[model samples]
Target chain A: MPLVDRVLLGPGPCNPYPEATLALAAPLLGHLDPEFLRILDETCDRLRTVWGTTNRRTLPLSGTGSIGMEAAFVNTVRPGTVVVVGVNGLFGVRMCEVASRYGAEVVRVDHEWGAPIDIRRMLDAHPKPDLVAAVHAETSTGVLSDIGGLAQAVHARDDNALVIADCVTSIAGMPLHIDEWGVDIAYAGTQKCLGVAPGLAPFTFSERAWARRVERPSTWYLDLGLIGDYVSGGAGGGRTYHHTAPTAMIASLHAGLGRILEEGLPAVHARHQAAGAQLQDGLAELGLKLFAADGHRLPQLTTVWVPEGVDSATIRTRLLRDFDIEIGAGAGEYATRVWRIGLMGPNATPARPALILAALRSLLG
Target chain B: MPLVDRVLLGPGPCNPYPEATLALAAPLLGHLDPEFLRILDETCDRLRTVWGTTNRRTLPLSGTGSIGMEAAFVNTVRPGTVVVVGVNGLFGVRMCEVASRYGAEVVRVDHEWGAPIDIRRMLDAHPKPDLVAAVHAETSTGVLSDIGGLAQAVHARDDNALVIADCVTSIAGMPLHIDEWGVDIAYAGTQKCLGVAPGLAPFTFSERAWARRVERPSTWYLDLGLIGDYVSGGAGGGRTYHHTAPTAMIASLHAGLGRILEEGLPAVHARHQAAGAQLQDGLAELGLKLFAADGHRLPQLTTVWVPEGVDSATIRTRLLRDFDIEIGAGAGEYATRVWRIGLMGPNATPARPALILAALRSLLG
Candidate 1:
């Protein structure tokens, strides 16, 4: 199956670590078994280290990133809960959508597609939003918002309002200091900077955030409190069955987390930065303009303007079919205007940028 | 990883086909890539066949089986929806819990843990109920409900009430005629008789069931209608983004489905039957009593009464740590009274019974 031999340079789901894939092939273990419980403990420890937090209330949700996004709100947001969701791209918009489903009255703070959200405006708009959520990195637009400042702004308005950040693209890619950033809750996917295949969503909630819950979460499956009790050990330190966890996927994530820590989170972040600079230089040499603003652009996911009069889809098809390479077509306002190239995870290397650039130049020129 | 060197005899997650694990090592693909879209088409078509339904609404939810169970109700049950749920095991109780989260007015029909639900009473108790839900196979007690008869009985009382089923342990293990049985909605996990790793939830819904929706499914992540539109190709046969699907998990499932089709459904069911009978014969020879009612037990999962004064947990731990074998602990009313020996998936073999029996005999004899 690996013989498909395509270079993945997409918005997310950058190529996973080879070790991660091998870990996936490892024999399955029952979720409640002692061996798996040990693995779960190690996985959670590694997650905490990379997240730059010591929060004990952390574990991977048994769904993909979107459900992880849902977990943050579904477990905290109740009917009549006022949520201030900042919208910069598709994922930000999705937060409002998911929150409203749980009966939250969402006040959306709209920002430009390729720009970081306006923190001051967001705090001013919703003085006492129950949950203030913003994407730490918008994969759709390749824009990275300043979560530290956002969290500070949120608490300045309402001391009890929880600050939630979507770190689907930013974790292990760039610096994300959860405790230092004052983020009360955050959720991230394994596919991006963690160099693991996409299946589980690693999430954490601060003690302050956990204490503020009004009622039991509406949903049963995604209830963090119930799941926490099961994972942190049921009453008297024994696990109660939560759900049949995706064993192989979790194993892959565990191995991926191990590699991240081995490399050190700061070093992984640095590699992504260097790779981003390499792609930026290559694109500039090709006479292409970067889509996101210079200062706020994400180092892992780079966006470039589609040359005028060139069909974006045609280039993508040719890249995949002929060159065995994959790049992402844009979404929303930028759908026809840009192409996103990812240098996340194991794909975050200068060689990847060089190869993709050569393929693109041959096709475009 | 399979070199952990243990034979799995759990209720579900029975030894997956080796090919499924290999497929997981395949290189990553973008969720919206053309190649993946083609793969998605093939996977859905294969699932439809296994489910014995022509319903185009079939697809694998991107989470574990519990979400699949949630999908049936979340998509249809609205606030104040009347739901008649029959309980005989832990999974039945799970159905009641999940359905209630969707605001369903659940009328729980209780039954003995090891006996089939009283269908006549269930139908008569909730006359004209909006929905009738039952478990086809109770993994906790190893009783297989007569779904075809139950479907007829539910319709006899309320023609409009949708008949839903938890086919987690039933699908592919034994005969299941979805369309012929008139089951409006059915859901299953991959790790069961399907012989795939645990991650994806393969599910199906009838045309009549699909047509009865009032408001959109309460939750977004498990919303089948939106996911169906995306998988079926959005407006104008164009695919749209839903959730970032777990590429490796889906690939593993695709390969698992291929193995099932190659074996052919009836032969697969027959294999399970043979394995079940062998285990039954061995258990009877050991002078152990089966827990479920005569002529009503599931072939895939066999429940046996634990000998008086034998610590079940100690035996389970010894079987795993000493003999490199894993079976299941009992649940609910049956807890401390029985052990669930699974013959599901590829592990359902006459040889498997012989191995487990010898180990049990050596332990007890």
Candidate 2:
């Protein structure tokens, strides 16, 4: 295959740090090796700091964020459990789907696509759910839901019920307080805001969430209760033998998290906001309307309206074929109506915005 | 963390080729990037050749081998599906656990922990199951089950029922003909015999397996039907989009597969056989008894009885602490009775056997 270089401005698989890539090439070590355990311990420590949480269960799941979502639902919601999900975008719908698969009686508080979740409606729903789930930053519509407000509303109804949140597109790029916000469980992917290739899912849980997992589910592979026990000295001598973790992926995550700490989380968030604003301004100058409302937009991912005369697929094709740049097409209702351009982690920079605008301007004209 | 070098002779997390690790360090690419799609296509093509099948639905699931096992069960067996699992070792017991998690009525065909699955007993079981699953190479006990004969037995009872096999420790290290062996679906991990690091689970399907997947379960993530649709033009215009794949892991797998091709699969198999024999001979000279019968032992893994006075954990710890070598402790029935030694992928060589034996002799004497 010919060498193809792409300026990744899509939803995920963001540009990785050079050091992160090098870390992936480190010599292979046994998953339970003491050296590798040190890596795991350090990675978990950094994840807790990046996620703004004090939860001890913070660790990387052995699969992608989607599987992390499944693990969260499968472990917490058994058959006959009632789960209330806030559905405004793709990930919200995904949460409802996963909950229902685990036999949860799912209730959805629906909002218009590209809008923040309706917190009032969610609270006023008829039956109190056994679990409340929402997405902090919806990747598809590029909307940042009011996670604090949602968590507050859920706790008001049923304090015992777990509050699950998908931080896939947010986490390191935005403010997430698992403990302060009373979030029982939260999951994030490594690819988007973490500036690493996709593989591992960094997840954390509160004491309440841990209690729920104690009632073991039928699924053995994702039995986080068993996994947590193994990782938390249950395996004996501070070593655990769970599934063979994605070793290289974990190494990359460690490097990425180290870079995140070096840059500092607050500064990283500010950079994302600045880069997002610049891109939004450039898009506006080129006559492109933003799909998400101004105050609710995610700084890491921006969704723009697809003009009527211009085909989304055609535009995306030209961007790749001509400019060697990649962007995300809309999903669900926005399939042909919008496009998602990511300014996440290492790609959140002034140079990327200029590159995207330059290519888009020529194509639009 | 201290830089610790230990030879991995455990069940997995074995030594990976440096080229494969370098491939993992390649620049991050979007999951759907044109270049990445090209890699994905080539990976499927290469995996098809390695699996010795012409099935169009061959692909890698973005999880560990255990998750691949879950995917097979969840997709193939619905609630109340009568599934018969061969139970001769730890992996087989794991199969039953996963099947039961999906609400399958699981029946076990029992055998001694270190023995191959009995074909006649499995055939004589009354009222043949809807799905029959077996482990090709049981890692826990170093027993090689007769997949060819097991497939025949399942077919004799009910040709319509599917046959699933776990080739976790056998795939490229031994001969496996997915089509000729009449296996409907099979999954293998990269770390074991594939000479890649742990992450991706390579899977392939027969036409019958595809038909079962069409009766989609409630699962959206493990739903091969949806994944196949997205990957095979079902999402329209052949533009595949799902979760972000572990791009680096896939790249490593591509490189690992290239190495396998370079060595040639037949030669790789022969090497494993030679290495297994060498280790067995060395163990015999040390007065240690082989756990599995002579003809039924797995070439990639060997289980040996722990002598009366020596603790299995102590010896394993000594190997790691004193010799800088890693080996596995047995599981379940053989937990305190045996130890597992692996000769897999890049670690499957004459030099490793000599090193392992010398270390064991020092510890035992």
User: Residue B200 of model 2: what lDDT?
Assistant: 87
How many angstroms is the interface RMSD of candidate 2? Answer: 1.6
Highest lDDT model number:
1
Model 2: DockQ score: 0.67
Q: Model 1: how far is A211 from its true place, Å?
A: 1.5
Deviation of model 1 at A6, angstroms: 1.4
TM-score versus the correct structure, for each prediction: 0.98, 0.96
Question: Candidate 2 - CAPRI tier?
Answer: medium
lDDT of 2 by residue, B216-244 (tens): 56556778877786555574556546677
| Residue-level lDDT tens digits of model 1 in A7-112 | 8899878888988988888888777677877888899999898888999888889888888888888878888889998999999999998999888999999988
lDDT score at residue A87, model 1, on the 0-100 scale: 95
* Model 1 ranges with Cα > 4 A deviation: A1-3, B1-3
Tens-place lDDT per residue, model 2, A36-147, is 8788889999999987788878889988889789888888887789888999888898898888878888988888888998888888764567888899999989999988
DockQ of predictions, in order shown? 0.71, 0.67
Report clash pairs, candidate 1: A26-B1, A27-B1, A27-B2
Candidate 2 chain A vs. true chain A: TM-score? 0.97
Candidate 2 displacement at residue B335 in angstroms: 3.2
